[model samples]
Target: MEFSQKIDVNILRRTTFSPRVKNARIHVICGPMFSGKTTSLIKAVKSHQKDGKKVFVFKPKLDNRYADEAVVSHDKNEVQAYAVEKSVEILDYYLNADVVAVDEVQFFDDRIIDVIEKIANDGKSVVVSGLDMDYLGRPFGSIPQLLTIADEVTKLNSVCTFCSGRARFSHRISEDNGIVVLGEKDKYVPLCRSCYNELKDK
Candidate 1:
């Protein structure tokens, strides 16, 4: 009667899926509008280029403020890039590239978080630049999560349009009430805490 419960422990063995781990490098540059986030990303990727590493630059298809397939800065600096609608599209072109750079990353879906993590886990350096917060001063899209997981984070600042002080927020000029409206100096302005609170409260 005591031997009735005897069973093989080997039957409980289960295969587990584990992604290969490497010294993945993820660098995120984020800030309010006019903060030179894109410019800093361009500089980082260019440095990688100087080191003889193959680079692939990409941007979300929604952003076309300057060029349809490029990352442009407020000062008119630009870099050619691939425009993709989905985060999964990046895998199609990044396999052979040593450095994968993404601009305007906040415009992409949450899938982007996994895509960049996978890219870096594959031993390629991943650099992303985007708005850390939306016009409403909330954490934007996947950028906040990316900032948390990144190996390095750069938070830049611009002068406030209201007080000429260090601006930490991107204020929306139009009352569109939409979270993803794309515009330049005409639709958005950088603001410091005082000005942002003052304007936002009103």
Candidate 2:
């Protein structure tokens, strides 16, 4: 005769609220490709850590440009991140965390707006970084809307590949007309408005 395994079904529900987490505020960091958006976001997270705040970093599951468990910068700095397929999932992870950061905000759907807003109102810091425009020079989905709700907005600049000027646009050279595309250094180049217009004119 074989014995069946018995499982414990009694567990206590969590109901305590954390006092360390304060009022939530949304921070948006946006720019074109190579504009150091991710770097700036990581810096903010590190600064929060230095202040003795409990911090959590997250990225969209669609962004596989870097490792799934960490957000890596061009300068090789690394920060552990939780990868979720949907922005709504972030709320579940914030239960006990003091600060919540979301990278690649552009990839998330419209629902992210309400989620980010609600989280911020609950007394936690929400930091988001993403490309403001797609390869077609159009606003990349929820990024523009998120900017409106953010408490602070920081726009970064990258070096234009053609003229070494301040790059403000991400020029898409690939055939993909869709807003979302995964690419490397060979796929897109940074350009200033003038240079970008010139390139499009050709």
Candidate 3:
């Protein structure tokens, strides 16, 4: 379903930020809506917890679709998390965390790149999940930049709602042109390239 959803967190279980390269790691899980990004993130966090490592999970304050104070997957799986307005705020909250995971990361500003990098550089593992492209099929926010520096990257696909083919895009059904319209089945549909292309220009 996803690439390495069972990331080994044991490599990051030591103290000390020295020689951070071996200890620090960044993993990214990205895809269109309904592709299970958040579900994968929840699994990754659980893996870290299973290893007895301290973890902190965060969601962009803009994402309140399923819940305001937790990261909830499309299937209703959830984990307690803090909602932060600024990416830098993630730093303040990860006081003793050995691993940090963020969902709906594309909603945050470019500062997220620096924040994620800083966390990893300090020897804490980081995993981020978000939409890789916007409604127009353009790279959304800082995801491209985040992907460039990730230690591991997994791009997932979903069943196209229209044709049941592999879906790698989110087709916006709403009339709003605003970039950040937080919504679910009412406003967006998972789509394959052909299905998306047919509707993109309409």
Candidate 4:
């Protein structure tokens, strides 16, 4: 018998492999403090959930300002999320998810960029929120990379506390010189370029 004739058609059909559809996309929300980045991320998650899509939300373990296992906005808007210390740990809870939302993304290590890319490439949509710049007015961790690779980028702006204009910089008000100090209105203030220059050195 010929090899083709001896082969089972059902087996061949079952063994065939096709690549996953390229429906994945990365969405990034970045801005200075109090610019509603987390709120935007939470909105995306809720929209996906309302459509009956399976969604996974994650926040850095270091971010516990509002809750230990939730993404909370400054206005008290909140959504439950997984608190992971490492970016790779997100994969452990992302199985079969249709949408993944990450808050306080700047707090995670550089590996977060790769993890988020992998998730999007696997045909799952990813939404990330973080500060684009540190208190020193420099690019924050992994946020620049995430912005570069994102399919959609939204840069929001808060009302500048000093001038009432659009805030573009996160100004530090406390005496601490550390780059990773986590605080709300007590330690950080959003300022426009002119206001920032005036207050940054003082």
Model 2 lDDT per residue over 85-179, tens place:
88889888887777888888898878899988877777788999999988768899898789888899999999999999999899987777677
TM-score of each: 0.87, 0.86, 0.88, 0.89
Please say which candidate is ahead in lDDT: 1 or 4: 4
Best by lDDT: 3
**lDDT (0 to 1) per candidate:** 0.90, 0.86, 0.92, 0.91
User: Model 1, 69-188: lDDT tens per residue?
Assistant: 778877777777999999999999999898899998999989999999889989898999999899989999998789889999999999999899999999999878889898878899
TM-score preference between candidates 2 and 3, better one: 3
Best model number under TM-score: 4
Model 4, runs deviating above 4 Å: 1-22
Model 4 TM-score (2 dp): 0.89
Model 4 lDDT-worst window of ten: 1-10
Estimate, for each residue in 88-142, the C-alpha lDDT of model 3 and write its tens digit: 9998988689999999999998999999998998889999999999988999999
Decide which is better by TM-score, 1 or 3. 3
Colliding residue pairs in candidate 1: none
The order of the candidates by TM-score, greatest first, is 4, 3, 1, 2
Residue pairs with clashing backbones, model 4: none
Tell me the number of clashing residue pairs for each predicted model.
Answer: 0, 5, 0, 0
